[model samples]
Target: MTTSAELLAAYDRQLRTDAETPSALDVEQLGPLRLVTFDGGRGFITYAGLDGADAGTIAGWVAGALGYFRNNPAIRHIEWKSRGHDWAPGLHVALVGNGFEPEESESIMIGRAADLAVDVPLPVGVALRQVTEEEDVRAMSAMADGVFGDPVSTATADSLLRRLSHADGMELWVAECGAEIVSAGRLEPVTGTDFAGIWGGATLQAWRGRGIYRALTAARARSALAMGKTLIHSDSTPYSRPILERSGFVKVSTTTPYIWRAPA
Candidate 1:
């Protein structure tokens, strides 16, 4: 049994780079940051750590990184992912000063896949399965966007389609009642590692507290285990954190994304 500390340390050391950016169009190293350009004009910044740089050095890195994206007209949106356990200094102030807005913080949760592989009962008439068809994928993405209170985005659906075309070991799962998708998430098995990620979990507001999401999670975990993945990890929002905690996941750390959008 791997302890939480050991798992987290491994997560920080091994699973931080291209593992998180399977579909990235390009990846560049900017000092201690990885500047990744994804499709749909989005940019992502992540790194293992700052390597003990001081506040002033970190601020300079922030400015230069933002500037690199700002100068690229195609990069419309940028996300700088910051972790709670990092030794970052003045990062918040620097990001805000560079016009990046902070989004909600989420817990970085990790645990063994077997721990989350327990059977969870679904509501009567609800069925869970993996989805692959374009129509099904678009429907699942729309339901997730609605649950997250974001406008329906064809770009997101298109991105998923592209990922699927690559056969990247990513599986999309949905729980449907009759013809409507009520809950959904994705299982992404990282290559060259023993970990898989459960991401994009969402359940309709009217369908909350019905254990559908848990069932969806368990389905993904089972798929991961079958693929020989031993570790399961997710960046969980408040709504899903308690459920994961009950399923034996530990709060390894916290992550917050600072966003910047280019002027139109």
Candidate 2:
């Protein structure tokens, strides 16, 4: 059994680069930050750590990072990805002062793919399948956004469609109850690494506690194994943390996304 510390170390070393941003349109470096631009006018900020920088230095970095995106007219939204274990000083205050809002934090869960590949029975009248078509992808994205209380956004669906067109080993899985999607998630196999990420896991409120998510996770784990991935990772919300923990995943760390939107 790999400990949480070991798993987190491995995650930082192997899964934090282009593997994490396969769809990035451009990536620029600002000191320790990887300033990435995605297709939907989105900017992302991520870094391994602050390298023992002081609060004043980190504040300067924050201002410079915001300036980098502010100069780009096409960029409307920016997300600064922060880890609980990082050595960032005064980062939260800086982000908040710069008009960034903190979203919910999630547990960074990791475990062997084989440990999560067990057989989980789906609910009666429910079926699971990989979705690709535009309609199905839209339906999946809508269900996911609704479950998370986000307004329906076509940009998300459009991005997923673009990724699907590339056939980049990213699989979208959905558990359907009759004609409606009850649960949905994505399986992203990292190129040049032994890991696969299970992201965007969402289950309809009424469908909770019925093993549909576990079954969906198992299905994805099986798919990851087929792709020759040995490790599985996820930034799991409170709703799905226990389920993954029960399935042999350990909480390696925590992650929070601070979001900033350009002034209208």
Candidate 3:
């Protein structure tokens, strides 16, 4: 078994991809930060190590990055990726000082696709399918927002619409009970890489431990294997971490998302 540090490095490497789509394989350099763009209008800022930076320099970097994003209105939102292990002094404060709000930190989980492909039992009357219609996608996104306790935003649905326009290999899946969406997630098969990412795994609070999320994960893993992807990666929250661990995912690293929202 690899150590946690080694696992984290591997996870980061898998996530940092470079593809025209939402692939994490590519990294573009914009001044001191690496500019990573995904399928949606999502931008990511990452750096190797932030050592020897005093408050003034850190604040300057923050302001510069924000200014760049402000100039680029095409980019809807950005996430400043932070590593707790690197001990970047005052980095979080700098980000906050520049209109970036911190969101819940997650552990980077990686595992073999085969390990997660086992048959998972789902609750009765539950079924999973890929959503392609605009109305169905919008309804699914709204239900997912409600399940995750987030305000229903057209942002997610709009992003999905754009993704549908491209109609690449990205897929969105959900578990439905009767006429309602109980659980939802996405499967991303990254071209030019051996990894596929499972994202937005959320289940309602009332249906916590009935294995719906795991079942949905397995269904996606099966799709990934069918697509010839060997590795799986996800930034998992505490709510879904233990279930992922049980399904053979290892805690490789942790990710803290610092977001820059439009001025209120």
Best by lDDT: 2
TM-score of each: 0.98, 0.98, 0.87
lDDT of 3 by residue, 1-264 (tens): 346666667655555535323644345665456767665567778876555677778788778777776776667788898866665677888998888999998987888899999998888899988888988888889988998788998988988877777766888998999888888998988877778889988788888789988999999999999999988888889988897898778887678989987654
For model 2, the superposed segments whose C-alpha errors exceed 4 Å read: none
Clashes by residue pair, model 3:
16-24, 17-24, 17-25, 17-26, 18-25, 18-26
Give each model's whole-structure lDDT: 0.93, 0.93, 0.79
TM-score rank, highest first?
A: 2, 1, 3
lDDT of 2 by residue, 112-166 (tens): 9998999988878999999998999999999999998999999999999999998
User: Of the pair 1 and 2, which is ahead by lDDT?
Assistant: 2
Q: Which regions of candidate 1 deviate over 4 angstroms? A: none
Q: Over 4 Å off in model 3, which ranges?
A: 1-6, 19-28, 36-43, 47-57, 73-76
The RMSD of every model to the true structure, in order and in angstroms, is 1.0, 0.9, 3.0
- What is the alpha-carbon RMSD of candidate 1 to the true structure? 1.0
Candidate 1, residue 193: the lDDT equals 88
- Candidate 1 local lDDT, 82-119, one digit each (tens): 99999998999999999999999999999889989989
Scored against the true structure, residue 136 in model 3 reaches a CA lDDT of: 81
Selected candidate, larger TM-score, 2 vs 3: 2
